[model samples]
Target: MREDTKYALITGASGDIGREIAIALAKQGFHLYLHYNRNEKAIALLQEELVLFGVDVIPIQADFTNSDAISRLQDSVFQLDVFVHAAGNSYYGLFQDMPDQEIANLWDIHVHFPMQLLQKWIPKLQRSDAGRIIFISSIWGEVGAAMEVAYSAVKGAQIAFCKALAQEIAASGTTVNVVSPGMVDTKMNHLFDEEEKTALLTDIPMHRFAKPSEVGEVVAFLASDRASYMTGQTMRLDGGWFMR
Candidate 1:
């Protein structure tokens, strides 16, 4: 709570990628508001681990699909210098066969809730000397995936949202950007079998999937003062895949 301390809120802090982001920020002396929907035990353990970095870590729980999630989140944190939207899930299946409820959940979790929360937090972010807003989007957002049609759609929406929001808020000294990662080695990608993963490796010029920590490192850099001039940009962390 020191006046000189920097604070960051990272949603989905329990996930592998989220955990890495939390660790990276903690190492940089950022007091964290670690948000998670479920997995209390996971987040609690993460909090313990982060304390070693000498930053205050507060865990907040809210189901992004719930209508009142925005209120719950807004009430939990009083100060924020950075907000990272890392909370998301992918629906893998034919777009036509995807259920109405699943699509709604995807939109609510990835887009609706985060947008509303940012709306509430913008004023606070503007007060900071260097505020940051980062979205952990997917490479599939830039290039659509076959079975993940709905997921691709939501991720793409995130990219567009950051681009527009960045322009609107640049004058306030706050930057908005997207980190679109490709084929990260996490539980989300664990849905694919070993053979499937091998095939995916062949597609990536790096011949391997991204580690969660690699994504975290990029996010930490973006949250730092070094990224002051950067805004409304989507940094593709796709390992030479889907270059644009």
Candidate 2:
């Protein structure tokens, strides 16, 4: 690693949106710490592709559902400039039908574990000249989704956390923000059938779901020095759907 190489730790780097974020950062010459729970093959493939960008790509695995894994993840990272929280799962069911264990799993994966990891990594971020903390939240976090109540709650929590943390660390030159994308065209949205997707399109003025690369580009900008002055703000990438 070069002395001036910037390191970015992206959780869920094997997933669709996460993979794009990793690629965007790599294109900007960032050494990547790609974190994944399972899908070793996906991470391996992504690692192979990222190396062409001439940046070091290190893969780290940790099940976020298990809090004890946080320590291991922290130990794996040496230096950090950006931390992107993109690891999450969405539950599609009525809030009442959701199981206690599933709710706990969502909370642990989306909020609790990430918070603990940040607690450990914040110091390293502060040491850097410009540090960025970004959360890949959802449009549902801004406008509640009926069946995804729990998912919306956790994402909303992420937004609140970002705003508060940005305030706490702004003096240190670290910026925290949320990228709440609406109806991203990823495998995650495959749960919606054709009819459902069509209906969703009608709501979005752009009449289309956002591409993963679009999300990645916005994230890349946030992680860059250009976004240094922008913190505690939510970048709504929802194509005019549920605009606030």
Q: Against the unseen true structure, what C-alpha lDDT does each candidate score?
A: 0.93, 0.93
Find the number of clashing residue pairs for candidate 2.
Answer: 0
Instruction: In angstroms, give how far residue 115 of model 1 lies from its true place.
Output: 0.4
Q: How far is candidate 1 from the true structure (C-alpha RMSD, Å)?
A: 0.8
TM-score of each: 0.98, 0.98
lDDT string, candidate 1, 82-199, tens digits = 9999999988889999999999999999999999999889998998898999999999889899999989999999999999999999999999999999999899888998899889
State the lDDT at 146 in candidate 2.
Answer: 98
User: Which ranges of candidate 1 are over 4 A from the true structure?
Assistant: none
How much is 103 displaced in model 1, in angstroms?
A: 0.1
User: How much lDDT does candidate 1 score?
Assistant: 0.93
Model 2: ten consecutive residues of lowest lDDT? 235-244
How high is the lDDT of residue 65 in model 1? 92
